[model samples]
Target: MVLRLNIDQIEPATRDWICKVQIVEIGRPRESLDKKCTFQNLILEDEQECQIRAVMYTDEIEQYVSTLKLFNTYLISTAKVKVSLTSYGKPIHRFYWILDKETVIEEIKPSDEVEKPLSPPNKLTITSFDRIPHLMVDSTAEIDVLAVVLHCGPQKTAGRSHHKCREITLCDNQQNQFLFTLWEDFGEIEGHEIYSKMATQRDLLVILGRSIGISTYQGLSLQTRYNSTVRVNPNYPQAVALLNWAKQNKTMLLSSPSDTTSTSSSITPMIVTPSGQQLLSIADISSAASMGVFCVNAEMAILDEFQDFCVLECSGCKQKKRTKDRKDFHCPKCNRKTSLVPRCSFQIDLIDNTATTTASISAELGEKLLSMTAEDIFDITCTKRQSLSLNPVHEMLSTKVFDIQLRKSSWTSSNTTTTTLSILSYMEKQHPPQSTTDRTSKKIKPLEISEVEVMPTTAAAAPSNAVGKLQPPTPTKKV
Candidate 1:
């Protein structure tokens, strides 16, 4: 036979020893000293919402913590209650619970008003992603849904701080993505392999509980709440279907509309020399400007040992000085030093990309380029040692061949004989642009440029010869 006792009516046992009792309320626990010790605050609604300091000792914690499911009724018989004072002038009850060897957990049940399942709730319906509801859900509400795994990995040191967190990105067909972050020790999971496996194969659906929430990283994530469950299987039919859909609509889903705009804006075409016959690549000008160099493509041939610094007339003051004073290399035209010396040292010439008719890269952009090698800039396989010795002509030559062969040139009039001589003089002055012998001596490493095999723009447009239909595995019980 089952016995039920009113929490408020229980009188203090004469022995003043721990007694067996049912726990009516398991209010949210309070964390103190950085969540080291959790203070379970409970209240006997029959008596009052009076604050109670229920301390779970470390050893006792191991037992009850696992059984402390949210919103589930539990029979915690072995517990000690004591009187404690609060910040206010009133006495409250404090329960110190410990599980002994003899303690046994009774049957766990959903809270009052248990709903009879029509079936096993096989058809799990997932509505739009919503915020985790404020109210607690009982174990009966457990359901499964097909969710795309966006990101998953073990916790790492966040920023410069010592705190660790695991970040996961998840998305669904609804065109919504959520970032899930598991904090502290909970962040360390099996490994990154789970994430890696899911990344290559989209349309993965894992069983999750309502305890999960949309994390700060804007991803759907789960916590170690008692009811949470997860599993992955390649054979699951639901998984197979979702995978097929994702593969079919991969291009439509992954392609961003703004990509076209950015691509077009970055490809700037301009003529750098007066001959105007040889069209200079806009990227070359951007690269030179970023390196603090001021010269046309024709003049670039003459540079040998690239200097670390350059002098430019300050666009603001029109005074020639080392371009280092202002953040954006501006000259102090309005200052008193402008007229006293007839030219202010503050006046710095802006390194403008005359080809694109734009200002030169700031000091920040130069620092970025310094960290990158010529190989990184030109997407070549030259060694680092070779990259350091690379001259402007070599940089131009490497890019010019591709431009000439692959793209159409916009020619201009004026093929002056002096232009050829000027170009030759510049090339001679530079470290005799890297010879074929030097390139051969450096041992060119095989380039690893992955060929981008573009897929059809739409599922319907896909070639009939396409290999297989994308399909996810069926949803099965999580192991």
Candidate 2:
């Protein structure tokens, strides 16, 4: 004969008792060594709510600890009962349960009983955000949910880091957002790529195996297990539904307030100009420089020169040990050897129209022209000349009118003191030959001299213009 008993009808008087009970709830064990207390709470419901606290010794806890997991239904027997006092001195009943080494745990198979009254969909469940619970389901279970993608990093290769995992910001229609991490190695869907694709397409759908709650900076978040399956496609029917839902609930997912503050607080690159006027192009420099442009300056001198390359002195100290030469300059400031060294320095090298001379200009005045491109250089020389009154020396350099600057010195009669200045303004003026005319006009063939042939003649000529020669007016007027 089979006997049925209600959970509430079970009496503590049944000594050395053996009773069968369905596990309505299962929880993780809590232990307190100072209080000499260790227990796990289980709830049973057989016509009424019955809560039982199962106590265990340290030895028994170690024996069956691995076999216990929350939410698994079990039939526990050989449990002892006792009365315990609450913090308020109220008496509470507790049970001391143990599973001997020889006792075997029999897995209870779920019944195929027909459903009775279904749970109301409107019932609200309270859960803690600090510790999210994991939901376990069989491999054959099917589920549907909505999720979001939060962060994505670069993809990696076999020998490199992998990029299959993506952190997601998920939410249900309940106005709640949770973080979900998806791993792609398993059959799980590609969440990051899907979210990116759907951002343009406007919707996504996902189906997965299990949901586990984990702690994150943003509180408790849900994650997908390896067995979870996700499907995201523009063609999915659920995606269409989600799009329609989003359209109706436009204000639900508002942008986080933190994002606006971050974007507004960003730093932009600093722009500095002497005239405080914005320059549009290289041609704009004529107007800009004429108004005194802003530029950084450094003191430098030519240390070495090669065929077409020259190195300038760099401002840095060098360490020195034993050296064969004892007369080298040493910088006591840096405690290193000090000497002019070859380094790249920005300076304008003037090239005349005749390709006859090139002179290096110092400071900001020099760097302005050197920084222009070949095309812009040609444009500046051909046009925009009047606006700048660009020193006559620079004009000749830009036009390639001649190839050399004259170096000259003068001695004062009273003290016989000598002063020297180098000027780049003198050179021959040779225009290209005019096109032949049909009438009696003579076509003069302009002489063309190569740079190599002009070097010796240029060197032999004595410095005539101690001060630079006056520059002629430009072909056009300033705008």
For residues 1-479, write the lDDT of model 1, one tens digit per residue. Answer: 23334344333452222222323334334444456865443322221222222445445556667665433333444345444433222223333233344444443354435521111112223433332211112212222345555346555644212356565544455534433444553354422445656667544434232224322111112333222223343334555665666666666644522112112222111111112123444335333312111223321211222222223333333344433333353224433332111111000011112322112211212212233421232222112212233454346444221111001111112421100000100111233323221121221121111233323211110011211121111233322
Residue 374 shift from truth in candidate 1, angstroms: 16
Q: Positional deviation of 213 in candidate 2, in angstroms? A: 20
Off by over 4 Å in 2: 1-4, 15-19, 24-26, 33-51, 69-71, 88-479
lDDT of 2 by residue, 1-479 (tens): 32344444445555433334444333334445355866444433222334443444556667767655433344444345444334322112343334454334433435524422211122112232211222111222222344332222222211012224444444444433444555444212365555566466543333221223232211123444422334442323444555556556644443421112112122111111112112132112212212111121111222111111212221232122222222346555445665532221122222211111112332212222233332233234333332223355344333332222222222333333222222211222345223311222221221112222111111101111121221211233334
**Lowest lDDT block of 10, candidate 2:** 454-463
Model 1: number of backbone collisions: 28
The lDDT, on a scale of 0 to 1, for candidate 2 is: 0.31
Best candidate according to TM-score: 1
Give the root-mean-square deviation of each candidate in angstroms: 24.4, 28.7
Query: Which one wins on lDDT?
Result: 2
User: How many pairs of residues collide in each model?
Assistant: 28, 9
